[model samples]
Target: MTAVMEPGMDAVETDAASSPYQGYVYAYPHKTAYRPLPDRPGLRGLWAGEPQRALSLYIHIPFCEIRCGFCNLFTRIGSPEGLTTAYLDALDRQATAVRAALDGDARFSVAAFGGGTPTYLTAAELTRLFDIAEQRMGADLRAVPLSVEASPDTATADRLAVLAERGTTRLSLGVQSFLDEEARSAVRPQKRAAVEEALGRVRAAGFPVLNIDLIYGIDGQTVASWLRSLDAALAWQPEELYLYPLYVRPLTGLGRRGAEDAGHDPAWDAQRLTLYRAGRDHLLAAGYRQVSMRMFRRTDAPDTGGGDHSCQTDGMVGLGCGARSYTSRLHYSFDYAVDARQVRGIIDDYVATTDFTRAEVGRHLTGDEPRRRHLLQSLLQADGLELAGYRQRFGSTPAEDFPAELAAFAARGWLAEGDADRLALTPEGLAHADAVGPALFSAAVRADMAAYELK
Candidate 1:
């Protein structure tokens, strides 16, 4: 499929047509665009006028048992003596300050614990983390849909018990592959037996949703192996599944090993696309519905409801050094890095910090950025964007605001034919979600991301 670029469109739209796996667009104006806030605006002032009724709460833990080859996340391997304790102490302090800043008006509609791995902590430590969220941040986990991430090794029975007892609605386990060789090839060393045991334990704990995450395009992975992994996960009858395409990014172990060459290889792209379609079809045939490019939910899965918290408009309060907080106009966080040494340094600085009242590093959303964010986040979902909602929010339709981009997408056959009420992606468009997403990035954001210096 060829994407004919409209005269005024950015070059990224052209690149999107050729390279379908450019990058994952999980969030707009990613952390790479953030800069030091010289004025260090107070958190209270940032949240004063922002709506807090349906806020989302997030807590980040930066320690992991081992670093995977394809990982470029801001995390370190292993917590040294007293490191976890100090980190928790800092988390508590930050939560206290942020809660005070919200001025007693905030109410969380959903919450999440993500990281390196939230379950890397001991069962008792998990209890303490929950207490801090409930006590200091005033997030009632029991009342909200609480999601947590876990790894196969850390999803122990005790940890699962603690998570279930504390009202965790979803537990997402990173089981990249069911085959041990493929797991090792991806630098995630785990046996199939252990993964199965962990899955059994998670099911026994009775969480509302069990999400198994698998990665396609791993070294030596073929269509058959990918299906095997998918079938293995299906055998467990998980409520959700996330199939991620392997990305060998700079600063990650795979990048250091020169594995990034495969990312640019046309043959590799074809292989990944083939594998993605096979897996997508298999899941759809097995009674799972596509939620996004990466997420698939079982048709009969229990709905853990928190529909009020909209990522495009709702405010989010993030605690922990690795977490990012979002208000209507600004997104803020502490320093971010993928290098091990730099990550440890940031964590140490976070632990030793006393005050948490001001925004240190962030980007302020301005003008059309909010509209772009709303459009980008909404369009990527399988449900697509409601034109009426967009018009109601911005007083302009997407067609009026983004005619050229929409035309370019239509040229590439990435857009679905829809009535005036909705705009959505075609199946091929969802397959190339990474490409479609980056193409929509604003020019200023792209420049900011490009200029970021990696540590």
Candidate 2:
């Protein structure tokens, strides 16, 4: 079907349709804007005075077999000899220091391994990765929900088995497209049969939840083709499906090509919108429900954010150079790098450093940024935000805290005054999530992000 006007395609959708691609506001106050901390705050103080909130741990694996054309995450295409081992060793040291800094009564309810591709490691390396997390952080993989990100090419049987035995609750695979051409256009080299094999392996491994990821807006994609890929994934009956809109960013393979090709096309935006609606409607009909704009899950699947994630209140403990640790007022990580040489240099520096007890680079949230963060995270969910809950946490209603912004959303008919004092997205509002999320960022943060150079 051709892309066309639909309900909720108001001025915002019109705006999206006119622009090249609405920026993906994954995390508010983009990491690009983060500056270095000269004092390099120590972890003991950050973790000691912290409230008794359940904590989530994130372990980053910065190695991948191939860098996709549309990818811009902090990871390298390949690992050199002994690089993985060195990286793991550094992780062990960081975790030990970080754990020592934490209060003894700290509780961990969930853990995740994310990166270029956690599955890129050998089975033995994978086991060691867990060792650092479990031994250093005292996070028992068997007790809490554990999630790991992987790619189809590297999800070997050995790695899958190790993950299963170690009690990984969720295994997410990036099967961007079933069509070989689409996959090629995205600069991800993989065969249909290989992806099928990987899926079968992951399922046989018996992780409670299996999430398959698909991308909708590649260089060459259409309504029928998008459905073909979606239908293929649904046939697998994955517990979760993440529909990602292809984003071309600077320093990415696709970004360079996109620069040379058609610079900006609103028509592409409309096509993506049409495809998104088709996919969302199809998933709902197939007994899957939306958790967020990008996330859908089978009705029978346990809550995606079942543990500490459900509270959505936990701060994350990040290990590895690409990881970011968070606190109530701050978020910090090692400097970020997209260039291969610089990334290697940063990784080498991290591995060589003896001091792993403190954070060296970060940004502090001020004014109502914390409140804004809570609202942004909550409002983006399909469940919406509760006014009483907001008041209880921040002592202010969403309407009062975000008076002008909420009013605009309500006036546009994108937001609804739901039952029990909840504010939710109308069908159209959810469609424009990419735009809405960025609109909520504070002026100062935006300015900081604009000024800072994204490595």
Best by TM-score: 1
Q: Which digits, one per residue and each the tens of the lDDT, describe model 2 over residues 1-455?
A: 00000011111222322353455655555666578998888888877777544888889888788878777777787887999999998999898999898888777778989888899999999999988888888987788889899888788899999999998999999889999999898888888999999999998898899999898887789888999999999988999999987766666677677542232566677788888999999999999989887889999987545575533356878899988877887888998876667777888898897889888888898898888788888787888887787888888887788898887777777786647688888777788777777677777776676676645
Question: After best superposition, candidate 1 residue 128: deviation in angstroms?
Answer: 0.5
Badly placed stretches (over 4 Å) of model 1 are 1-14
The superposed Cα distance between candidate 1 and the true structure at residue 303, in angstroms, equals 1.0
Question: For model 2, what is the error of residue 164's alpha carbon versus the real structure, in angstroms, after optimal superposition?
Answer: 0.1
Each candidate: what lDDT? 0.87, 0.79
The TM-score, computed over Cα atoms with residue i paired to residue i, of candidate 1 is 0.96
Q: Candidate 2, 115: how far from true, in Å?
A: 0.4
RMSD of 1: 4.4
Q: For each of the candidates, give the backbone clash count.
A: 0, 0
Residue-level lDDT tens digits of model 1 in 1-455: 00000011122334677788877776777888889999999999999988999999999999889888877777899988999999999999999899999957679999999887899999999999999999998888988899999988899999889999999999999888999999899887789999999888999999999998899999899999899999999999999999888887777788789775667789899999999999999999999999899889999999899748999889888999988999998999999888899999999999999999999999999978998899899989988899998999999988888887788888999899956689999999899888888888888888877778877
